[model samples]
Target: MKTVAFYRIGMIICTSSILLLLISSLIYNLLPDNDIPQMLLLRDDNGRIIGDAPFAPSWQFPFGTDREGYDIGYKLLEGAVYTIGAAIIISLLSFIVAFGIGIIGGFSKFRVKSFAHKFFTSFYFIPQSIIAYNILYPVIWEPMEGFTTTLSERIVIEVLVLAIITVPTTAILISNETEQILGEEFITSATVLGGSPLFIFYKHVLPHLKMRLFIIYPKIVIQMLLIIAHLGFFTLYFGGTDVCYTPFCHPPKPFIQEWSGMMGTSYKELGLSWWIFMGPLLCFTVTTLLLNGIVKCIEGLIDHEPYKSKQTSRENETHSFESHSKQEKFLFIKN
Candidate 1:
């Protein structure tokens, strides 16, 4: 059989997951409530309710349901946009900022690079999840009266906070990678050949950097996902949390059906019903696995890509030299 790229498998899995989630979200919006099952309790053939809502994993409900009778699977599908979509957005924003800063740090003087490197290196010691939770809790958690900020505004603030916290660490890694690439002899050779900084970078440096960025991008996405999940554990969910602070303290509710939100709200069910917690937890695990798989595939692709290019170039050079040598011999010593 011919060789097949590992990245294609990753792409298929990723694309199918996203499309499934999008379709579920679309169906949720377009279809009526009756179309989607919301069973209050288990019913017998006689149509008499036997058990309460929040059913366990059964033929009727594969993933099970929450206390409100909403299917865990359906909620996951609808919330995929909020969860994965937001992770992607945050990662992209963080990447853009880190990439710009990294380019400067990579190209700038020793002092600038050193300061940046040393300063940002300190952030690595602090756990990202803890930082995200503290920063997000105040803004997203509803007060006694109600939320001061609108849903969109709160989401924007949360996204920005998450993106910003990641900037320091991501930038440092990018800067280091850039520095390594710039240290290559070809870069110096290109410079000696009178290549402009922009030209040398675009032609030689960028191709290498692109591979690193590809590897880095998915890693950042995975990181953002973990941070968001941690925030969820703290009940600092995205789209804000609505808490009831009355005499009977009702549990906080999430504005969206997000995976993290699902986990945050249903974590208490771990004692009473473990399946609810498992639903979202499994989702996060699968998503993380997929992202990690993508990372592996990309690394594999990068590893082989250079070898293939070098081999091809060598073959071409040898072929050209052999042809030229033959031509010279024929012309110099013809009978």
Candidate 2:
């Protein structure tokens, strides 16, 4: 009961937060202009940049100003859209690839599964950050084409990178789960009854696999988000354009307004204003918590054994009652 209550609380919080984020993303994407908040613009005497420009946080500006005089709040909100969007794209792509490969490998003949396992083994040890960095090299060296592309292209890049990074681990995990299920008595009986391998695997095995995958989805999303955050901290993200003062871009610009990008830019300016760093840091922390909460919720949802057992017990009671009724009627008829 305690565990179930905890999960319920977590689910409510995570769902609310994610919904807020999605709404904010929709608003930001729809907005025509991406101007720095008026409060963050350079101020003239009397806290005005030229004549009427404002300075610092007030009702007009909630998060104050950055070193560049940009509204920290606006930027932070915009950043959330990119970070969340990227994470979603990556998570979905990774799941699709991992699910396909895992199912195939899990149900394959022994020889095929062995070869697939060996193929994935080499990638199992690669560090995610290193893999993300290596993947970024092409984007960095090529003409900056990612920025001019549509929103879908930007999402595609994130998804591809995340899928590549996450596939091996997810594949291994799902394959292991499937392998265990394949060893069950029902699976053996199905095989003995001349059930086709594919049909048995799909009809019998995948029902259980679906529940396991739901439980795993949140974990995979968290891992992919972490990887993207690390890459963003290094300024290797896509869709962001940085003004170049140097002949060549030194620290690569972030692709979009991202939590890591905000952190990358503002962590050093912590002395300027705690709000600058605190806002993004808080966001990152909360997002991590949200992901963990979501995982717990998913686990709770899939943990049907408790419910199933109760259901079975009820059915047994009903069956026993009916049996007793029939016996009483038989005795009455005999009398």
The top-ranked prediction according to TM-score is 1
lDDT of 2 by residue, 160-236 (tens): 76687888889888988988988887667566655677766655677667767877887887787777667766765
How does residue 111 of candidate 1 score in lDDT?
Answer: 67
Each model's lDDT? 0.80, 0.70
Off by over 4 Å in 1: 1-7, 30-36, 307-335
lDDT of 1 at 160: 94
Q: Return the lDDT, model 2, position 183.
A: 88
Q: How well is each residue in 1-335 modelled by candidate 1, as lDDT tens digits?
A: 01235566766777577667666776675666624468787788998878988899888789998887888777777777789889999999999999998877877777666766887899999999998878888899998888888999999998899999999998988888878977887667556555576765665666667768988998999999999898888888888888887887778888877889889888889999899999989988988888887778777666655534445434533554465456653336668
